[model samples]
Target chain A: MKINLALAQINTKLGDVEANLAKHLEYIEKAKAEKTDLLVFPELSLTGYVLQDLVASVAHKPVEDDPVFKHILAASRDLDLVVGFVDEDSRHRFYIASAYLSGGKLVHVHHKVYLPTYGLFDEGRFFAWGDAVRAFDTRFGRVGMLICEDFWHASPPYLLWLDGADIMLFSSASPGRGLNDKEKLESARWVERVTKAYASMFTSFVVHSNRVGYEDGLHFWGGATAFDPNGEELAHGPYNEEAITYTQLDLNQLRRTRARLPLLRDERTALVQKELDRILNRG
Target chain B: MADINLTLNTDLARDILSGFIKSEITRVGLSRAVIGLSGGLDSALSCALAVAALGRENVLAVRMPYKASSKDSLDHAQLLIDQLDIPNKTIEITDMVEPLFQLDPDISNMRKGNIMARERMIVLYDQSEVFKGLVVGTSNKTEILLGYSTLYGDSASAMNPIGDLYKTQVRQLSRAMNIPAPIIDKPPSADLWADQTDEKELGFTYEEADKLLYLLVDQRYSPQEAVEAGFNKKFVDTVTTRIRRNQFKRMQPPIAKVSNRTIGYDFLYLRDWGT
Candidate 1:
């Protein structure tokens, strides 16, 4: 049950949704050539991040309604693709979402939960938060999907773990600043450590992909990484560089690790929920 | 429309300041103006121009502080006021801001920082009413081009004197005016949060960012040309993208085109519209 995963770190042009989609298609072809079981792309890969008001004009409807998405779906008939795009709901609110495509069918969509409104980021001004934590059943395994800032929170992944997801994929378009080198490294290390810990606890493989190159004032530092079920770093990409990182994961090895670890089986959900409720209520 | 140009020298700076202040005053029809004295170089130079145009008594300096603001910022602000001998007042906004934060604890530190900035503006505008003066802005061209100031916060001003000068040019002008060297050399900051610096948040030194910006925007260099000119491609792209992305912040709200001569919709006027 070994599967290969490919993370595409592509530089995207801002506001050029068509060009970006073309770039994504090219990368997908490259990933397919490399015999990738799952191909992951960075957040907002279709239109680029920080488009400001342009997101309102350029954001597409669901996959069925969007012609570009239809093309992507048609091209993805033979590949398992995880790509980010702008999704506009019926209420006209846009969302930063990643679509999972398998066998030319839309499998699942994960909306980015955390809309960063801090310095140089105004995602909140343009996007609405997602409400569901979904783990779709795939041929490789039970795959859990989360967008950037979604994995930043502990609750969503923890919930997906409880839903019996055997593998996790996270995508991001995190920007880089020169003075924030230490902060960036610390955040990357934190993501790695937390995902690895989650993987070991749930006996799952975790794959994370981020964009590279500069968009506006923010530089997307591409540091895509992965961890096996035993919480070991399998592969990592270079920071501030575009790359396609590949890793092979064995589900049989994950099962063996789960059996040996036995951490998930001894879980206490009711108590955890109660404690979480208490904390949320306190705030 | 002959592409107005001036030499980057002390005499030219003084002449430009004099003309700019008079034009702005005449355009707004306000005899007095109020400025938030942060004791930073931008404000010191702005205060000097305000005094030169409206006299020391006609200019009012307001010092607003939060709890975590550095003592040195307050001291320097007071020193500038004393040196200029302008009528000024100090107001602490910590108490006003803290209670609001207590009501909504989920507000992030970043949002809280923005709230502090807006609070300071609220005081400035309020004092503008009290003193019957216009709120003078101190933001330089570098910050304005980069969209570094908070919109409707620090960016909200009746009129700005140094909005067209780069940060390096501001320093040069400050030296010509004989303003304190400490103010000019100090790390530029908004003093929004404790130990927060602008260059730290922007990720590059002001000198580098400003020079790079001048090359790309003013000198009309393409991204490739800027990179070939010894600037990092990533840095150039970042600055250019920021300027493009934040262009909306620098203009009036987008309007629906209904009238033939609407203010921002159809009838386009230069910045010195009334003047």
Candidate 2:
């Protein structure tokens, strides 16, 4: 099957949900015009990142009746949409989350399991830890979502792959840091390498959408990118600028690559699980 | 010991810094910037960047020269103003600061210099209000790290574009941006007194200091480790001591924790909150 995806690399106002909602609607309309099958926004697309004390105020439940999700769900009737926001549970605990809405229904909600607290990030100080990493059925295929730091660790995406996800949608509000001789940011280059490696290793399509513009002193280099199951870069957005990049993803590439490699088919989950159990419970 | 590479991709740096200046200023409902140009490299680069971000018409460069400030200082500033074609004002601060100087007949050079800097800051802020612009700062990373600036004087600003660039890095970028040759090549100075130059006052060249600082601060080297990295042990000790001693100049006044969430301690929110 072939799927059309739109990676929206946008600039968001810090802690302003209303203005961000308008921007999402505008991007959805543009994606629809381009006949996109799925539209993905960067992490914290609804409420901006760096919301230390303001996280609770911007948090919302991604239910059908939610003031923000209602418009998003309505837009999903035309095409599937993935958006990032602060998710509040029944007990008022907040998580950095992404929700996938398709056919006017919330299909999957992924709470970011890893909140990086080191070196310029303060997500752990304000957000509750997420304990789930599961893939769900989407209109395109079985897909999983991971926000920023979650994908930085290999375990989450590996678990998603084991759970039968053929597509991995990774989003980030990654700030630009470290300059290289090639004029590319160190952070941007590292992300591109990781996403492509994951694509080739897991034999799945990987799509990454990163936000652009500045918040406080942190500059987020946009540079949204995609890789096929063959680990070939299919599309790349501009660096340090806002843009929407669209690419046609052929899901059949997964079948061709996996048939050749056969790494997933030869997996031994039981032995791996037993080893992990022994390592954790070692005397 | 390996050499620390401080070279920046001027194109990328220009794009990022200009975007930063534009976003930080406009997010607060202001579209213009008012910068105090010292006819030195740092201020010249800051003014050029502000013009790039907010346009030449939006940035107002103000030259606040003291009586003892060099004639070349004013002329160099005028050359930048003419080159960038930005709006400018030359405000002589001699008369404004005379009352305080006259009050102290035995005033020290440091006190007089502080008075000149604070008076220039006053002029900048007042012109910022008149021009509906925010004050932009020009202190580079080297001086900021060494506490080479007077607190609340030249250090005060609504935002700073070049604060993170070290002195040598600032010169590299300034040359790339095509700042006037005289401004970029001349010996760095505060021009606070008749013969005041930064290196002569600090007793060290910015080149040597930048390398040692990169090892100590950026590379997180200890004083012993820096000495092992080919730096003199005394240089490392002096720089580290100065950095520690000037910690107060870098931070907000601490508030006592009286509530469940104290400001800057627990009640944390970014400066771009709600904007």
Candidate 1 lDDT over A204-260, as tens digits, reads 888888987654234466889988889888999877667899988878887688788
Scored by TM-score, the top model is 2
- Give the fraction of reference interface contacts each candidate recovers: 0.00, 0.75
> Poorest 10 consecutive residues of model 1 chain B by lDDT?
B1-10
Q: After superposition, how far is residue B101 of candidate 1 from its true place, in Å?
A: 52
Off by over 4 Å in 1: A62-65, A177-184, A276-283, B1-275
Question: Residue by residue across B1-275, what tens digits does model 1's lDDT show?
Answer: 11212226565455446445644665457788899988788988988888887889989999998888999899889888888899999999999999988988698878888888899899999999999888888889899998888889888887777887788878888888878777878899888777789899989988888778777766677878878878877888889898898897798898787776666543432343212
**Best by DockQ, which number?**
2
DockQ of each: 0.02, 0.76
**Residue clash pairs of candidate 2:** none
How good is the docking of model 2, by CAPRI class? medium
